[model samples]
Target: MSHHATPVPRHRAPAQPTTDYDVIIIGAGSAGLSAALALGRCLRRVLVCDGGPPRNAPSPGVQSFFTRDGIKPAELLRVGLAQLEPYETVEVRRAQVQRVKPAGRTFTVEAEGKSGRTFTATARKLLLATGVEDELPPVPGMRDLWGRGVLHCPYCHGWEVRNQPLAVYGQGKIVTGMALLVSRWAPDLVVCTDGPGHLSDNARRRLRQQKIKVNEEPISHLEGTAGGQLRNIVFQSGEKLARHALFVHPHQHQRSTLAEQLGCRLTSKGAVWINKHSQTSISGLYAAGDTTSGPQKALLAAAEGMEAAIAIHETLTREECPK
Candidate 1:
């Protein structure tokens, strides 16, 4: 299977012919590829730099997509490529962006491939569709069951694990919101935090009314089977809580450093800051998807990407017109 990862070392490949383009997309994910398609449909020459490092590769299939719900991840990419194949002005390269710097009039990108290859390209405008990654708990046996039974998004995995024994694992302050919402999916839901979280009196009462147990012990380990399917959670107080699925509130980080490197302001939570119109602090730079400030989900990312593309089109059009 083809794979993508953040290149630890700068791997340089055989040099290829270099050229400029109307716009350069730094990722080929759901958002990045969608933006490239929209711009290309507008007759804008576009090139997408994606070493195929999609953040959702771990997902078995993409559900709740409205039109293409239940489509497998790799299948979705294949279909997207097929649709864009007729667009002669568009090109996709399997390269990961290492660094991006603005030149006198264009943006320069250095991308490294896993096969020890490096690529350089230029574009008039830059699109940051790089998504985010989840930060799991420090406890052992978590990564093995990460995407299988330990999930983060309720919209994605809620229905699958619905009505089962579920637990919400979070830090001192992160589990409350998820606990309240996940209660609807599973009747036997519990909130497990590092300690008795700073829950308001009202929240505490509401949780008790729902019969959801609240535990204050620090987590010892997220116990699970050998093949990555979660089973139970172990507590520091020598308690093993049987659970079928776990909802974790993972700390998130932006996948691409290019935005921060280009002076894109970040929210307190480290997500890229964008205006209501999806425009970032940087004039020509735009960000969307999970990288920006919002609830991270498949549909949300798609919508944000489209909205940002609209703002980008407007700005570039205004720039092209003589004031």
Candidate 2:
């Protein structure tokens, strides 16, 4: 019998806090940590606050990332945090930032630590690396099997269950496209429209021509194994379809309310609008990663963080220089 070893969990040790810093990062995920490394390399006083669960904490491993492909999501973060240890200028705190307020040229951020104590810190610039939250379907047992059997992006999870009996949980017109996308991995596909969708007659005709099954009956619930691995789809009519995996298009929103609280402009897709340099509409505040518009990937988020950090550093340098 072949045995697989379980990866050890890594924890971030809290660092002593100071009253002021050059840059205050609101998240400690890929984007925030990457930005901290960039700023710390420049010897800028930076503090990173990590409050809640990481978005990819449930994912088994990251994919398509150069060199780090197939690495466990938690392990990748552990490596990133470890890289920051050499820089004394970068301080990390395991706390959730409760609120952020603009104070003249600086910003005041209030955060609550794990100990139930609240504290405040002021910074010349702020980076909102807080990623978005995936809103799973309200179907029973769906949330439990989210990253496992109930998945979102096709590029992310399609290959894992490739060639198996697959189904797309289509809820809207947008999901009609997702159903087609998933067809690339599993030819034997079915589009389960939980209810009547916005799909036009032409789209329905095309889907049928492709021989993909479309079931519009409301889903009663998802049946899964004890480990949350999907087994079958149970419908309102008491009919069940054997399926190994389910693809879904979920609604996403910013994990933190700080962006909305700051009056930052949002894109039509509901993400924070950011310029090429990752600067938000509000001066002295910037954003990166899933909070901003674009494809959401760990490597891409890290690159965006690097860009934002450089922009923040240059802007601060030009202003602080005695001209």
Candidate 3:
């Protein structure tokens, strides 16, 4: 695809444009925000629309995140907004993007909610930073207590819940592997599949060697304490097990329905496909963060965003320069 031409008067954009934008970014999370920051610095007349919902929202503190470790997710966004102010070239809007369509050399974007509006970006490029959503088991209290006691990412919440009695719930062998890794942090662990069978025999032996109990009991439901901390898990046979925390392997789904709607190719992992430069299949379009396949770390996403922003700068500049 041809590189996007820079938007005309790429300053702080007007309220709404009749033609198109120079660039419209569709997420405001770490990757999207980082990309916006770079573009704003380049003076690219950029607008970022984020629903403000990120996969990491459930956890109180983000660990292994370099200098910003142990900070609330919302607090990071606050800092991003403040830093972005210096550029005077980026505008961040809180909106849930519904759809995106490329027409000729421009694109039309429709966003929804009190945060909803329709506008055309006359500019030549697009960036998607929308993240993913985790699919948790149908336990009574799991979803409500997601980022709390019932956690998905071990690296993020493992240290906090380390050394505590933990319950590992999973379906098949995938859970078995996770149980082995989790046992490293918490010695006392219980591995169970609510249904008939998932883990194979060889997998079972490794789990047993590690002293992690593998139970094949059908789970009736989960029981939690007042603070939403996972307490005792109840099995179908009225059996109960004591646990302070429940670790799970979240089945994830891409939250960017807009990507599919826009014909962006999706990989097997459900992430938007991109080149090393973060450029997607459609020319002039780019993606970063969880939306792109690879690692799901916040720090990594930020780096990818910065890289994509640089590419955006080069591409736009090259396209706009007079021949």
Candidate 4:
């Protein structure tokens, strides 16, 4: 299938001012689409709002996803959206959700389209699959090489760069941990603290035991090839360390504030906290994928979405049956 094919058809008309949808999914990534598939199969009305490109858009392809491994990120989503077409009860809108308001049991969502048109949608339950945003280092050339030479997840990009010269960017115990983890893929690894690694004696010993070199010099900037692949790490002292790839554990924050807007509890890491059923602290509000805590992977996010849908369906069933 052509990757350029329209994932979801555009709806020119405004959403009706009624709470007709059983669930309002705020994201159209793997998680949201998986939930829609489950809910749609259950004969429930679901509205999935496509909030534009996902966090992994910069990546060339999705890794470690069973069967679909190495598929382009956009192509994976296009396949997901295409699969939902058979379910008439499921509708997808390409809009940016701005705010979510709670009305007793139901919830009201306000979103704006690309054409500057605004619309309101209401549903009995809300699912937030909105992912997180990676805050890359301020060093030059970092963003340009993101998902290419500057990768964060080892499992996702390690094999491709295995046995190649690599570097882990961070400081203190975090960098220590990352260096050790990344060493499994590349024996030739170094830790670039960018000045003052803040490492404990034990941490340094561990890294030394692993034969990982530590560089405390502040990085002047990263040098990359014309194709955006990392070439070397240039230090302030005018020294350059040749490296094929650099791994980092960048800080992250929620991509959307809808969870906070609806008063959902959040972990210290800023991910939406959820119960076993994928329901958030607030009743009837569900969250899955990178929005919630734990390992962030496409396959795992899809599983979480399916679990959340099953729970939501059971909850709705209980309400209707009234045992």
Tens-place lDDT digits, model 3, residues 1-323? 89998888645432433454578888888898899888988888888887866788777877788899898988887887789988777877777777777876667777764424554444578888888888988877788778887887788888999899997888677788789889989899988788775677898898889999877888877788666677778888999998888888888888878788778888987889999878999988899998888878888888988999999999877656634
Across residues 58-112, which tens digit of lDDT does each residue of candidate 1 receive? 7766879879887877888787777888788889887888998887546788888
Distance from true location, Cα of 121 in model 4, Å = 1.2
Predicted model with the maximum TM-score: 4
Full-model lDDT for every candidate? 0.79, 0.88, 0.82, 0.92
lDDT of 4 by residue, 116-228 (tens): 89999889889999999999999988999998989999999999899999999999988999899999999899999999999999999999999999999999999998777
Q: Report model 3's TM-score to 2 decimal places.
A: 0.90
The TM-score that candidate 2 achieves is 0.92
Candidates 1 and 3: which is better by TM-score? 3
Q: What is the TM-score of each candidate against the true structure?
A: 0.87, 0.92, 0.90, 0.93
lDDT comparing candidate 1 with the true structure: 0.79
Model 1 misplaced regions, further than 4 Å? 1-19
Ranking by TM-score: 4, 2, 3, 1
Worst 10 residues of 4 by lDDT: 9-18
Q: Could you tell me which 10 consecutive residues in candidate 1 have the lowest summed lDDT?
A: 10-19
Off by over 4 Å in 4: 1-18
Q: What TM-score does candidate 1 get on C-alpha atoms? A: 0.87
